[model samples]
Target: MIGLVLAAGAGRRLRPYTDTLPKALVPVDGDTTVLDLTLGNFAEVGLTEVAIVVGYRKEAVYARKEALEAKYGLKITLVDNDKAEEWNNAYSLWCARDVLKRGVILANGDTVHPVSVEKTLLAARGKGQKIILALDTVKNLADEEMKVITQDGKGVQRITKLMDPATATGEYIGVTLIEPEAAEELADALKTTFERDPDLYYEDGYQELVNRGFTVDVEPIGEVTWVEIDNHEDLAKGREIACQY
Candidate 1:
C-alpha cells in the first residue's frame, strides 16, 4: 500500500513561523521538525513508499523529503498542488490521483502518531468496507474536530467538522484507509459534487458516499497516541507526546 501525506496547506493559522516556511518544516523538538516526526511514524509502520502533497513553500517540503531520503535512504515522492490556495485537502488528494488507489493510507502532515497506524491500515483492508476512519474516544475534542455519527457500531451515519461538543458522539481522527472501489466511489462523489457546486468542501464528498449506503467503519484506536498540531497549544502537546515515544 502507498502512503499519501497531505502537507499542502498554507497554514495561515500558524502565523510567523509559516510566513517563510511550510508548516511541515516547523521545528517541534530539538532537531526534528513536525514533518520528520510524521514521516518517522510512517517509517516505523514499514511504509517505504510515500507521496507527499506540497503547496505552500513547496520547495522546503521537497528539500526536506530529499534530505530524509538521502539520510535514511527512504523513498518519498513529492506531488505539488499549484492550486492548493484555491481549494482544500480534497484537492490535494486529487493531485495524487495516480497513487491513491486500493488499500491507500492518507495521513495529515500536521499530526504525529505512534507506529500502530500501519496496523490500523492493515486491519481495515480485509473488512470489505469502502471507507474506514480512525476514531479516538478522547475527552479533549473541540468543536473544530471531525465528529463521527455511527450506527450499529459499524457504519458511519455522518461525519461533521462543525458541531456542538455536547452533541458530538465521537471524533474522526484524520487517518483513513480506503479500498480501490471506495477510491473510485470517492472520486465519483467528489466529481459530482464539484460539478454541482464548485465550493463544496471535501468532507461533503465522504458524506455523499455515506449517504449512498457505503459502509464507513469507525475503527477505534485506543491508547495509541496521535497529536494534531494546528497552533501553539498543539505544538506543546505534540512535544509532550513525542517525549513518551
Candidate 2:
C-alpha cells in the first residue's frame, strides 16, 4: 500500500509561517517538518511510495519535493487540489481518489505523531475491516475533537465534531488504513460529502461511510504523544512533544 497525506489546507490560523509555506512544512524539531516526520514514519513502516495532496503555497512543496524524497528514501507523488484554499479537506482527500485505489495509510499533514501510531494501524490490518482509524481512547475529549462512537461488535456508529463529547468513545487521530476494497466507496462518499457542502471535513466522509452501513473499525493507539496542529497553541504543543518522538 502507498502512503497518502492530506497537506492541502491553508491553515489560515497560522499566519506568517503559513504565508510562504504550508502547515506541513512548519518546523517542529529544528529543521524537521511535520511532513518530514510523517514521511519518516511511513518509511519506518516500509511504505516507501507516498502521495501528498498539495495546495495553498504548493510551490514550497514542489521546491522541496526532491530534497524530501532523497532524505526519506521514498518516491513521491503530488496530488494537486486547486480548491484547497476555498474548500475543506473532504475535497482535498477526494482529489487523491486515483491514488487511493492502491490502498493507503493516510496521515494528515498537520498532525505530529510517532511511528507507533502508524504501526498500530498497520498491525490491525487483515482483521476483515476495510477502514481502520487510529483512535485515542486516552485523551480527554472536547468540542473540537473528532469524536467517535462504536456499537458492540458493530464497528463505528458515528464520527463527528458536533457530537456530545461525553458520549464519544474516543477521538480519531487523523490516521487511517483504507484497504483497496473500501477505496471506491470512500471516494464516492467523499465526493458526496464535498458536493453536499464544500466546507465539510473528510471525517464527515467517514461518517457517510458509516451512514451507508460500511463497517469502520478503530484501533486504539494506547497513550501516545500526538498533536494535530491547527493554531499557534497547537504548534507550540507539537514542538514540545515532537522532540520526544
Candidate 1, residue 34: how far the Cα is off, in Å: 2.4
Model 1: per-residue Cα lDDT over 133-179, one tens digit each? 77886646777788877888558877877777666667776778776
Candidate 2 Cα outliers beyond 4 Å, as residue runs = none
Colliding residue pairs in candidate 1: 102-180
* C-alpha lDDT of residue 112 in model 1: 73
Q: Give residue 33's error in model 2 in angstroms.
A: 0.6
The sequence of per-residue lDDT tens digits that candidate 2 reaches over residues 1-245 is: 99999998888898889999899999999999999999999999999899999998999999999999999999999999999889999999999999989999999999999999999998999869999999999999999999999887888999999989999999999999999899899999999999999999999999999999899999999989899999999999999999997
Which regions of candidate 1 deviate over 4 angstroms? 194-201
lDDT of 2: 0.94
